[model samples]
Target: MDLDAYVAAHAFEWQRLEALTKKRRLTGAEADELVERYQQVATHLSVVRTSAPDPSLVAHLSSLLSRARNRAAGGRTGTWRGVQLFFTDRFPAALYRLRWWWITTLVVNVVVTGVMIWWLLDHPLVEQSLLSPAEVDQLVNHDFEDYYSEYAASHFAAQVWVNNAWVAALCLALGILGFPIVYLLFTNMANVAILGSIMIRHDHGAHFWGLLLPHGLLELTAVFVAAGVGLKLFWSWVEPGELTRSQSIAREGRTAGTVALGLVAVLFVSGVIEAFVTPSGLPTWARVGIGILAEAVFFAYVFVLGRQAFHRGQTGDVDASLLEDRVATQA
Candidate 1:
């Protein structure tokens, strides 16, 4: 397709459009020229995309066209509609689209935790090396339960929210590096497995399950979601398929950002349950039931709303009209 020759033929028009777009003010003639140059470059972009499809050139043209369009339209600001669309469409679609990643993460972690607990239980020496008899007794009888009730419920909820949010944020932020997410998730599950093994060994299995299930179900699920999204970000660049690494990473990064924002609310709900429901005077059945219900509702939201948004062609990236068109087909 002689991509170089086509780019050379149209470079001047693109440069002229860029210059006009950056101008502080435009006379009527210059304004008309800006619009003319915009249209010409837009055509050049279309032809280049159809005939040559060079990644770098297409990205450059797309950026230039976006700026020109915005400059021509006088730019726009954020609005309530955008926020509403993010929750109702973008966020859910992202979760739904990436459901398998997180669901698989959840399953794998669960199995790992189960195996870890079983192994720990089989080796009393392992528990003894980690914690002395007094420490184990303190944890099994009082410390574990006391940890939840030591602080006021509201204060504890806030603390839990912040801590979990930070972990989730770390997953999304360090996801590009890949191994950090694995390390973080492993350490997390190891802690749970350690505590469960210790308590169950001391004939406190009922007490442990009662306290953990009410909040752990939804809380851990949120963590799994974050880890899953983070790994997906890592995979985007690793196996970008037809996309250039930058394009794939950029698209997934935006979707990851949406998931990060949505997880804040999810963690808050789990935090509230951890502080209030987990430590409340309610019986084991009710507390566990509340936790189960929250987890069920969360999955329903993802599968129902997210699936609808995905089917409607929402990929959780920012509006397509404002970005480069990467494919001929919608979504």
Candidate 2:
């Protein structure tokens, strides 16, 4: 094929396709003509690639065909539809699909924390090593309870939210490293265990539980979810099953991203509880009850909505059409 002669013949059709694509509205005849032009230009591109193989011409035709294709396919989805789809399908399904990872993380961490607290209670020397006698007294007598009300509730809520969100984000970001996620979880649980031991030994066990449970229940759950998702991302590549390692990592990474974004809201709720409810004059049972309620609601959200979304084939990833096009290859 003579490249110059071919370009001369199809240039008009390409220009017409570009023009029709740029139109804001089209009459019936013009719409029909646009489709006709689009087909011609696509064919022109294919022939150029196969016969002439001019990079510049092929590139121009490729760009033109892309725009024409989007126009024919009705362009992008509406903003409301995208947002609704995210909450209804993407976020929840991701939670449900990765339930085991986070759930196991939550259980194991809780057990580790319990063991640490029990060990510290039995071994008094550990507390003295971690904190001086005066520091332990200060924390047990005043610091532990006062920490919640030290700042205005609203100010403190924002602060807690930002801090916890950063932790969750870090877990997700460092999850591929494997060790970092384990280190983060360990440090977090250790802090709680250390504090619990000091408080319980000082006869402030109920007080500690009162202040912690209201917010800790949901807050810790969010962190566990992040760690679990991160671990899943690490394992995705390690044991990719049938998919290629890259494919597995990419799939789990997207799910991790969804979990990360969703946890922001979860942490915010927990922050509110920690700031307001934890320090409130309500009975400990009531405060803990509210925390339990929030935690229950979250699990229900995952099991109910997430499970439903998963059953429908939702993998917490972006729409297939929106993902970049891929070319198949053989090993």
Candidates' C-alpha lDDT: 0.89, 0.88
Please provide, for model 1 over 1-331, each residue's C-alpha lDDT reduced to its tens digit, 9 standing for 90 to 100.
Answer: 7988877877789889999999987788887887678767777777777787889988898889888878765532155766677788988999999999999999999999999999999999999899999999999989999999999999999999999999999999999999999999999999999999999999999999999999999999989999999999999999999999999999999889989999999999999999999999999999999999999999898999999999999987777545653333211
lDDT string for model 2 (1-331, tens) is 7899888887888888999999998788887887678767767777777787888888898888788777765533445776677788899999998889999999999999999999989999988888998998899998988999999999999999999999999999999989999999999999999999898888889999988999999999999999999999999989999999999998898888888888988999999999999999999999999999999999999999999999999989766644443422211
Cα-lDDT of candidate 1: 0.89
The best candidate in terms of lDDT: 1
Model 2: clashing residue pairs?
A: none
Off by over 4 Å in 2: 1-52, 61-78, 327-331
Worst 10 residues of 2 by lDDT: 322-331
